[model samples]
Target: MSTKELINNIDSFVSTDVWSPLDPYKDEKIIFQKGDGAYIWDINGKRYVDFINGKGSILLGHNDSDINQLLIESISNKSSTVTGPHQYIVALSEIILRDLKRDHYKIAYFSTGTEAVKASVNMVRMASKKSIILSSGYHGWDPLWYHDNGPHELNKNDILDVFFVPDLLKRAITNNKGNIAAFVISPDYVYLSEKTYNELFSICREHEIYIICDDVKQGYRYRSGNSLEMVGERADLYVFAKGLSNGNRLSCVVGPEQVMEFSRDFTYTSYYELLPYISALGTLKKMRNQNGYMQIRNIGATFLNNLREILKNSPIDMNVNGNGNLFQFVFPNDEIEEKFYRLCLLNGLLFFNGDNQCPNLAITNEVYDFVLKVITQVIEQLSSNYNTGSFSINDERRFISAWRQMDGASDFIDTSDRLIIINKLFSE
Candidate 1:
């Protein structure tokens, strides 16, 4: 069947169209066929350079030969999935602990980052015997942690929200006082500083509140281990997923003996799955051997620097935020941002519009050069249309709202203090 027919069939049965909500093209959606490295092809045989990278889960890139081989071998050996615990789980845990330098921490397996975050939140609450959870950054879509109009009514008393700003965080802590059980922070290196992190850590530590580092999205992308280690501070518990298994269904919560012991009360059948464990083992081993983390960082840094250089003399007042591995474009307004997004899609460049772009290790030099060329062209077009007063906002093509809803971009608190810091760091 054709792409249109397939989409029609899907629309007939699928209750929600989750994938194409942010796709600017309202007429037709691009149905992806296959992906290898930093590129994906639609069913129509059109190719696009994919910067989304499975929403930052494709660490080593899509269809990695080594990871594929490992899965095949495991399945052929009759060891892919079993009814009980397996050796791969133990081995992967050892490697994870050693890499994180947290030898005292134990691991609990889960299928998704959301599951891991939920498990971590429950563990912290149970261990502390406190109901309040002061949280910052995205922690999955579970109703227990996520609510569109703020904390859900049931969880309002349980989850209090805060921003990365030190003063804001301090106020939340003071307001909640001894009621706060733990401060769950999902670090965004782009919006926060090491000094701020240390301050937050100290504040929570002083009040005897447990710290749960929700490193689900920014975990392996930023560094080899979790974001906690990169900031020179440790958390009471760490939640890791996304790139953990390089696009496979795997997530894990790791913490010390006392904190992790609470996990015994939370168990599920699929937690014993062995395929994801094997995938994690292979992905981790390959990353270490090839220095994949550093390579990714370098690629992202180089791309950002080059893009900045290209945009330096442009007419548009645009800025890029975050580090090499993860960054986003801060357009002057919604119209310009949507224009850029539409142009990029037209040019066969898939960026995470209105969200962060996660560059992976599989992006070759050729891919980088091609992406830069497309971006340069897109910028030039945007500049001409914007400067010539020909830029008109398409009312029917609105995508920022959908993007914000899909990725929770609007959920973040972008304080003026944080903006000043980001501007200073990325200033030309």
Candidate 2:
């Protein structure tokens, strides 16, 4: 079908245009047809290097052969989902525990990262007998920690108190001491300084608060051995999803037996469909054998280092954020950045979502070289325009603020209700 036909069909059945705001151009959205390795093809047969990488879930690349083979083999063998329990689930749990280098922790499964977060919230509140939660970063759309408060802020009466710095955490804990059950955080992709993390660890421990590490985004990419290890601390409960199964719909919570036992009666998801578990087993096995984590880090570092070197002599002010696995480009001005995005797209590169690049293990030298060439070309054009004073900002439509935590353009745009805020800011 044509793009218009596909849009019409979708509009007929789809109730919500939930992803409308993520369109970089704020115009037509491309319908992806297929993905292989580090690239994807849209319905129009146009190909683009998939730097978003399934929003950081496709760590091994799209349609990875080993994972696909496992799924195919399982489906062919009629691996039916049993109602009560399954060996594959147990095996996935075992692999998680083994890879995380933790023993004596029980594991529970769910179908999505949000479900896993919900489960973590339930587990902590029950275990600690507290009703309040303190959180930082995005922990999925579960109502426990998130409130629909006009996009920029959380509800004032929310049971969850969010903080960006360690001092705020300390203050919040002091103000709501006995009611706070857990401190939830996700720093696998974002920046959480070691000092701040240690303080969070120290404060939570002193107050008898459980620290829930929401590792849904970082999980396997951060490392097979506990993501918290990189920050020099561990949490009471770690919720994992995304890259765990390389695009499989599976998530799990791993914690001590005492903490996880509260979830015995809380098990409420039919995620034991078996296919995702099998995929998880295969993906984890392959990641271990190949040291995929280090490989991704190396790839990201190499790309960023080369990018820095290439732009060193250029007049454009640029900076890079994130670690070796996931990073974003920061341009000197919003106009330049916007034009750069358009130029990249016009030149057959999909530099959308503000140049956030999440490289997977499949990013070969050739693939990265192509990416570098595109970027260099764009940068050269941007530099020429900058020198000539020809670059003009056209549209200022920004990405939705809710996607700020995951999106790279977040730094360049406001997260609040823009219209309301602008009206309020400059009211005559």
The candidate that wins on lDDT is 1
Which tens-of-lDDT digit does each residue in 317-386 have in candidate 2?
A: 6556676777766654567767877677666566546634678888887888888899899888878766
lDDT per residue for candidate 1 within 56-114, as digits (tens), equals 88888888889899888888987755467888888988877876787678998888989
Model 1 gets an lDDT of 0.75
> Of the candidates shown, which would achieve the greatest TM-score relative to the real structure?
1
Scored by CA lDDT, what does every candidate get? 0.75, 0.72
RMSD of 2: 5.0
**Which regions of candidate 1 deviate over 4 angstroms?**
147-157, 388-428
